[model samples]
Target: MVSFGDSKFVKKVCGITQASYQHGWDERNGGNVSLRLTAEDLVGFDDVSEVKRTLDLGFDAKVLSGSYFLVTATGRYFRNVISQPGLDLGLVKITDDGQHADLLWGYEDGAKPTSEFPSHLMSHIKRLKVDPEQRVVMHCHPTNVIALSFTHELDERSITRLLWKMQAESLVVFPEGVGIIPYMTPGTNEIGKATSDKMSEFRTVIWPHHGIFGTGDDLDEAFGLIETVEKAAAIYSQICAQGGEIRQEITDEQLGDLAHAFGVVASPKFLS
Candidate 1:
């Protein structure tokens, strides 16, 4: 049997957490990540069904019952994940009843999953409905994206158009555009439901003045989605700092051509 320590999933979690910290996206424990896992992924791990403990999820996850997830622990700094994966990450299986999660491995120091687990789970549930391959949910405070929340209009259509024009790759990376949710207290069912609802139509959702929730089929895809938006936000920030005047930017027609070339459908509502 392969030890959990040597599992690829564990390594992936650790690597992403380290990268997030290095990029200044997850200061302290300000962000969280959760990756849905299939039974095939746990084939080599012994005692996969043994529950070390149970945690109340505060929301029913019946739809995800019997599924497994690897998530960063609550209050655990991303900076420490690479060096101490066992203490900063955990493997949990949603109980059949859906009211609790059974700890299967990791979180060796008795840490719990991130406070945003509900949001992550909700997102996972919603995304999977749209794309069966969906497997990852990542939340982080990208400096520029959060800054844009303060200076840019909160309307999803406006924010989507602005980010699409800020960089050439914006439309391709997030062709469906981004979702925006007004400021709300984090780690609650209300926020989770709001974010999840957005996930039904968008792969990325920005929590105004907070952070972003990105979903994808894997860690890199999810992280890249957030990274692309954040980079576009940063470019917009630089443009504003230079004068807040647009001399030239990607036009709607040009955006259409680019989207056509990429074979991706840019959000129609934002286009002329």
Candidate 2:
């Protein structure tokens, strides 16, 4: 059995958390990541059956019963993850009933999973129903995306169209567009449910005045989705700062052409 410290999963989590911190997306303990792990991914780790401890999920998650996830720990700083992964991350297996999880590795400091664990699980459950391959859910307070929530209209259609117009790659990266949820207390079942409901239709969801939730088939895909959207938001913020006036921007027809060229469908509602 390979040592947990040398496992590829541990290395991936460390790298991502550190990179996120470097990008300024995760400050202090502000962001969290959860990756669904398959049985195959546990091959190098020893003693899968051993449970270091059990944690109550606070809510039923029977839909994800028996699944394993690698998640960041609560109150742990992303900047510290690379240097002390075992203390900042954990490997947990959802109980057969899903009301609890068993720690299989990591979490060396006896820390619990992220406070948003339910939110992550909620997203994973919904995303899996739509895209069975979905494996990662990432949440962070991206400056521009959060700023736009305050200045721009919260109407999903308008925000989606605005973001699509901000960058040519925006439409291609998230053709279904983004989902917007009115301000709701984070880390609660209500917000988790709202975010999950949105995930049924869109891969990205903006928590008005807070941050964004992005899901994908892997960590990179999920992180890239958030990064692309945040970049567009940053461009929009810059334009607004220069002068909240738009002399020219990507038109609907051009968006259509770009989508066609990319062989991807832009959101019909936004396009119209």
Candidate 3:
């Protein structure tokens, strides 16, 4: 429950993530999104009224804590998704002493914390800077993206290259590089490593047959890149299935520009 910055933008991003989540794309109970927001407490419940205000403005507060909330909840079937009005949600708020965040309340049905809660917490407090003003993380399992990770015959490196070519923005934003972690059981320590290791080099990481974990300064930008990556993968899957080669690819220089636009970290020398 380390305190991080907050943002109204996160609420906006959560709204978008919820739409994608409930639409049968990320899979019911398969994807997760965590957003950091301005800290109201070193560790305390976020003003529930303010949370309500954000929701009134059409933000989704799935795992609302004090200053942070997860966009998705745990335990509910994706079909019976608790995505509507007046739904109860639980969150862990950081206490004022800068010690820890405690569980505040339960959403309708008294939902418990998500199994990926540790990952969410770590992403916010431990791994990367999960401040609201700085980062929004969305993790999902789009079918095509997950499908690419399950195969034995496909060249992993080549898969990303082809997908990036399909959407030039990916090549730039993720230009430092994308990574593939060997499969690990969902919500396990191993999976956390899979996520943590790639945090520095790439903003998004794919979990084979599982889902995607993405982060960014803004929520839409982060999630949008993921959608692009997913769409590109979908196209590549279709083309490769037809036994045809990808028709075009962006040069490394073009990728550099894309990364710069996204505010991705670059080596000191590259800055000059």
For candidate 3, the lDDT comes to 0.55
* Candidate 3 runs further than 4 Å off: 1-14, 40-67, 77-88, 95-100, 126-133, 152-157, 247-272
Give residue 270's lDDT in candidate 1 (0 to 100): 82
What is each predicted model's overall lDDT from 0 to 1?
A: 0.92, 0.91, 0.55
Assess candidate 1 and give its lDDT.
0.92
Tens digits of per-residue lDDT for model 3, 1-272 = 32111324323544665667664565545666655554442335343423222121111222343454544456543333334312323444444433334443334354554566556554544334433444567777787887777753334366566565667665655554455676788776557755766665566777777777777777777777687788777777888798867555566566567666777654333322
Ranking by TM-score: 1, 2, 3
Best by TM-score: 1
Q: Candidate 2 local accuracy as lDDT?
A: 0.91
Which residue ranges in model 1 land beyond 4 Å of their true spot?
Answer: none
Candidate 2 Cα errors over 4 Å, as ranges: none
* TM-score for each candidate, following the candidate numbering: 0.98, 0.97, 0.70
* Worst 10 contiguous positions by lDDT, candidate 3: 52-61
